[model samples]
Target: MSERLSSRSLPVEWAPKVDPRELSIGIVHLGLGAFHRAHQAVFTEHAAAITGESRWGISGVSQRSASVREQLAPQDGLYSVLTRGLDSPSVQVIGSMREVLTAPEDPAAVVARIADPAVTLVTLTVTEKGYRAVAGGGLDLADPEIQADLAGRPPRTVVGQLAAGLVRRAETGAGPLTILSCDNLVANGPFLRRLMEDYAAALVSVPEARVEAVSSRQRLAEQLESTRFPAGMVDRIVPATTDADREEAARLLGVRDEALVVAEPFIQWVIEDDFAGARPAWERAGAVLTDDVAPWEQAKLRMLNATHSMLAYLGGLRGYETIAEAVRDAELAELAGELMTRDVVPTLTPPDGLDLTAYGASVLERFANPALKHRTAQVAMDGSVKLPVRLLGTVRDRLEAGAEPRVASLAVAGWMVYVAAGRDVNGRELPLDDPQAARLREAAASAGPGPAGLVDAMLSIESVFDKELAADKLFRSLLIEGVGSLQSH
Candidate 1:
């Protein structure tokens, strides 16, 4: 414990007193990180506070990062959440997490808990690259980890872990459990299900005799469709933690917390209603529940994430650190504003009663938050993994509708320049995180000849830009312009 600095009358735990151990772990969250704490945990806490149902409390699971557990579990699964605005910050202690399970510590136990009947739902916030989808809703069978988990006869990756758990739940006659995917990936629920099912099917893809034995034991593999998968759209500008954030969190919480998460004041979760058995009062907690989340997904993918990629690539090349820092540049900021309001929003139909202009304004404001130190390097990671859906998909959609793709073309140019970077405008080494970085770098080094060969090869990867798009006259013309910009800049 440390000295208490605040004289405010509020208790250290401002949230209502509710023993989470008394409640079963109805929700198991994967990739327990800052976003989960600031978004889903806060929502769950509010739901629990109002409904007094602790069963919705979360059992957080982490395989790679045990540091979050180190910070959160010490306070008896308690941690402070700060929502930052322009002037002041609002603080609250979230207590909806019942326990933090380190899967690496006890994989079997994690599997068993997921199999438990009391856990009715599983939510995942694993980053987009973690999905390991090859392309077009199919599994990346080439992934060594996925292959290992299939061979090892237990779960290794998140999808594999989840499939094993689901099988266990089915064997014991546990009722249907909803698998809610809260990541920004398009059609997240169906995408997750396909990945999971692919992993499960790979288990029995061996010889006939071996396949028969495995199938007999893991009969629940075929019953995956019965398990609900709800697509969702989550919005918040929670930046990566820095030394300053760590120190500030320790000062406020009266103890050092490595897993402390700082976020902006705004948050939104719009989910498609598809719970199997029971769920928390998400609607009561201000979540927008609808029969269809597609329109909302489209808007977010095109407007928010699309613009984010633009800032990320361009900002990195220009040596900007955070989104706020980049947006502070008048030229870049205006470009982003125009992209959202003009090219992107035209294609999207905002949900009923939701104002697109107001939403766009709010998004810009959030992007300019000085408090959130979201790094360009962080956002710039896995670009080879993100380009197709985040940029080209939207561009293709617009082209199919016979609309102009000026902003989209600009973003694509930014990516090309970003990938070819040896140094930023500040002479800082640009850390490009793409599978084809080396190839791109080599191609860029030999830019004496036409760069079209490099562009053609990159576009042919099937994972990023599709073959059909590569053949389009307008698309190729845009790429030519984009490539010219890259060489000049």
Candidate 2:
């Protein structure tokens, strides 16, 4: 066997007798990252294992660069998922992926794979920023990459790739496809549908359309209209694997696994049952298939995701290295609990059968998993985009109800202090790695001194805050006080 982990190097007992080479790629995943590898891919593999299906193979597309491709290509798309629960660590070899493609390196190959008649479902987990949508909503047509794709170049963005592939599928009369979004957005499926519609509208409105362009635009719109964009809720604590994790995995398997992903033992996927065609028997593998995934999506987003961001910002500002450590701080933990119990829970009508109290407790327990080593910095990155998705909804709801979201405001205040001061309480440099970092930093610096001007400045940013939210007297007062307290810390 080679030094690296591959089919030959993997423990034969960990897999079914089915050979990897015989499977066909039926699903094309847009973002080939740790979460999808640990969550959806694992579910797909287990589903196929139960049914002995060979056509449920995954062809993962690393949208940004070739790093993931480089890691998995040599290993026959086999990677070990190191589940870091509270107990001892365990490793398992997964063979759900048949191949990994770098979209940037070969965009045409990606489109062609998606166009395959055999493929019926396309899943995405490209994070919030990947959508390239504007601050409020809709596609950012002015984006250079989106503009380039519109100019007949290879589609580079996630939407562009899907658009091009859908056009091809429509032109070739490929059967209906399901485009499921596993991201943390609200009503992910319908939200994705809106994004696609926006893209299709942009394409259809391309001025002075040539005969060929007109044909392509019409086909793109038709295909997207027919495609299923089912909303989904995915939950798992997939931490970025570190050298220590790889070392432990190598020791466990007796072979180096370069493409390792670390995750918690707990995983839950709530998918709306609206696929256009056949899909994996994911329900057989513990996924909840319901007529309404909204309840589940809301519960996860407002409760779990909102708390995750709060811990990230407040914890990162406190100089904690990992989420586990951050949550270990007694005061921060209380605030996080309050944010869920006192604030976020009120805004959510939890999906049926989900006890919001127990769910919130379980969420904190998951966040406190010491073995997972979920970094505060990693979670805290891209706050400018993350804030709206995670925290602001509850803030909005609370504001409308004439209630003061004191704890929620503190979380937002933590973010401002984290960004404005650019250092932990210990004076360690806190990295402000946001898409709107320059403008945010400028807002902080330009707003004179003290928390009053700083809070006003941060709230004034159009991309991150709704004008109404910024103008609210209660929200402003709370933010100023929260910022002042955090600064004093």
Candidate 3:
């Protein structure tokens, strides 16, 4: 074997799509993780390669941790995306990432990067929790990081950091910025904008003008108004890299790759074309630039994501390790389909040139890709935060249309049972690793020992279920029945 994967070690054939040394950082990306490296970074590289443009290089910031920064820094910000299809996996080195920054280590540097005039665009994939919204859809004022940022800390939280950066932009007269959120949150653009507004509004209450916040409240609001937060829908299954995966990557490359990320063959990004400043021509790289990303977002959130979570909870409870193994089980496979067709499909307005039937089939096929090795317990995490965006909308729609959301309720029930049981059928520990795990488990434990009891107890959680949904006799009955049936397994 050769030395580790660096700009120096790559074979001629495996040279990055774009030359790393020549490219300059024009995009400051928050949440430098597997998904961003596999999805957007690759697309940006492709877009640059096809257009012969090199200004859209990325400055990746690892927010929660410095591990990703550590992984890629020695490699000259280089990494290989191992695309695992049905047959053999394909390895490609990505070069668009020019610089890596750890947000916590140098929060001011992150704000400076965002404020840099050369960096016209900022993107985020910091997951749902990164948004840090209260259940009622505003910035979580109680979050300590937010409080710290408002109290004149260096802005550690994502929202705090973004607010600081935008305020910096306003001060510097850096032209309008396009803040594209590449997470799976519903109406992500508008949601993020609202969070920013909440943050900016909260800054006003700080008796003294916070140094990290805007000195002029109206000026910061105007800067926010000028900025564009475009909603984007991204799809790809990037699994946690294991030693086996690293070994395989080494075998393929004749060199060890520390920052190797693996993914399924399928990858798609549908972006809303509402940028406030110049941006990458992502369409050149096979991204869909559309006027309305809502339909696509809705379809993905409800159909694929909701179904994926359903399979995860159900499959984890049934003792399956990976999603492929779970979907391969005939009964679990059938349940996934029913959730898609019977419950989710009827509620969606399929985007132009999309076939709900074919999309459903393809999603199932993607889920069944064994090479990806997407874990059931991993997807099963953060169910309380995920359920509203992924499943509850369908439940609400079906109920509004005067129909029973049977399979959807079953999906919700799967989560409930998974949380309560905390183990698979074979006595393997299926971790209840949710942001709201403590509260949810407390509710589960306090409930009287039965399906109805669990249902009644969880329904009382206003964060997950509103007054109307919790009050619905049909929903309660379905959940109780669903929970009861799953517990019998």
Worst 10 residues of 1 by lDDT: 1-10
Candidate 2 runs further than 4 Å off: 16-18, 207-209
Record all residue pairs in model 3 with backbone atoms less than 3 Å apart, i.e. clashing. none
Per-residue lDDT over 1-489 for candidate 1, one digit per residue giving the tens place of the 0 to 100 score:
443222232254554355545666788888888889989988888887778886887889886768877776556677767666787665676667778888777777778878889988889988777777886768888888777666655565788778778877777888788999988788999888888777767777644457553863366565586788889999888877677776776665555555567888888899999888899998888999999898888887778788888998888888898888998989889888888887888778788877888877877788888888788887777777677767777787789999878778888878777776657888998787776577666655655445565466556556666678878878767776766766676
The lDDT per prediction is: 0.77, 0.88, 0.89
Model 1 residue 371 CA deviation in Å: 1.6
- Report the backbone clash tally of model 1: 0
Alpha carbon lDDT at 108, candidate 1: 77
Q: Residue 421 CA error for candidate 1 (Å)?
A: 0.5
> What overall lDDT, based on C-alpha atoms, would model 2 receive against the true structure?
0.88
Measured against the true structure, the TM-scores of the candidates, in listed sequence, are 0.92, 0.98, 0.98
The TM-score of predicted model 2 comes to 0.98
lDDT minimum window of 10 residues, candidate 3: 208-217
Residue 386 C-alpha lDDT in model 3: 92
**Candidate 2's error at 225, in angstroms?**
2.7
lDDT of 3 by residue, 308-343 (tens): 999999999889999999999999999999998998
